[model samples]
Target: MTILQTMVSVMLAAILTDNYVLSKFMGICPFLGVSKKLSSSLGMGAAVIFVMACAAAVTYPVYQLLVAFDLAYLQTVAFILIIALFVQLVEIVMRKLLPPLYKALGVYLPLITTNCAVLGVTLNNIDDGYSFGLSVWNAVCVGMGFTLSLIIFAGVRSKLENADIPETFKGIPATLIAASIVSLSFSAFSGMI
Candidate 1:
């Protein structure tokens, strides 16, 4: 396939067929935690997108350097450090510019530092042997997919607030059920590309 076709397929696969949260099941903590409110979800999603993209951009070159030095095994450490730096940048910006969102995100903001999804994207890019541009594009697409899942689940959770249900299935149990159903719906996108 041409470069354009490859990019498009990668985008679709990342955002739909292989969503990190809904499909691959990475980063479920922030997915379930900060998704309680639409505003918070959007804020967290944007932060994650920025961090993931930046991490990919930096990590790609860093990985190349590591490979050249025969220190490739240190990639996980290097990538995590890069991801943490961006997450800190995001945290400072959010705290200064949007205190409410900063407060809303709470521990989850710092938790982004350890988010496996962000780290996973960087590693996946290297493992898949994608070029620098494709690596960054894949990260953005994956972040979008993460955002889409959060927004949809937030809507569902809001509806659940008003729905009558058995006491046994209330709260976390109900949320899990909703998440699973949403995940199942995403399965339809599988093989579409």
Candidate 2:
């Protein structure tokens, strides 16, 4: 297949068929933490998309070179540094370009710096033997998938604020139940790729 076809396939697969969070359960913290409101969820998701894409773009080439040199054991450390610097770059850009958005998403952005989902996408890209372009595309689509799930959850959570759910299944319980249904619904896409 052409590079374009490969990129598109990896991206579509990550977003629809095997989302990092819903399908693989890589980053559940922000999935549950910042999803209380749609606005914040969107912000968080966007930040993730940017970070993951850049990280994948950079790390795919770097890690593969390291592996070729028999330094594969350094993947974790190298990936950490790469993710941190990439997120820092994003933070700087956001702070300069959109101060209000930076302020609004201040805490969440830092939290995402260490998000497994970001690093997981990078690692997955390497693990799957995708080319650099394919890694970036997959990271982007996976980030979009995360955003989609978070936004929907946020909307549901907001409405459920006044719900009369049973006392035994209130708060996190309700959230988990809701997420389970979402996960199950997303499960249908497992075969699409």
Q: What TM-score goes with each of the models?
A: 0.90, 0.90
Residue clash pairs of candidate 1: none
- Which run of 10 residues does model 1 get worst, by summed lDDT? 101-110
lDDT of 2 by residue, 1-193 (tens): 8877777777777777887888899789999998998888988988888778888888987887898999999999999998888778778888999999788766677888779998888887888887676777788899998998889889888888898999999889988888898889889887777
Each model's lDDT: 0.90, 0.85
Tens-digit lDDT string for candidate 1 (1-193): 9999999999999999999999999989888888999988887888788778988999998998999999999998888888888778777888899888778664466878878899999999999999999999999999999999999999999999999989999889989999999999999999898
The segments of candidate 2 whose C-alpha lies over 4 angstroms from its true place after superposition are: 97-101
Candidate 2 accuracy as TM-score: 0.90
Residue-level lDDT for 150 in candidate 2:
89
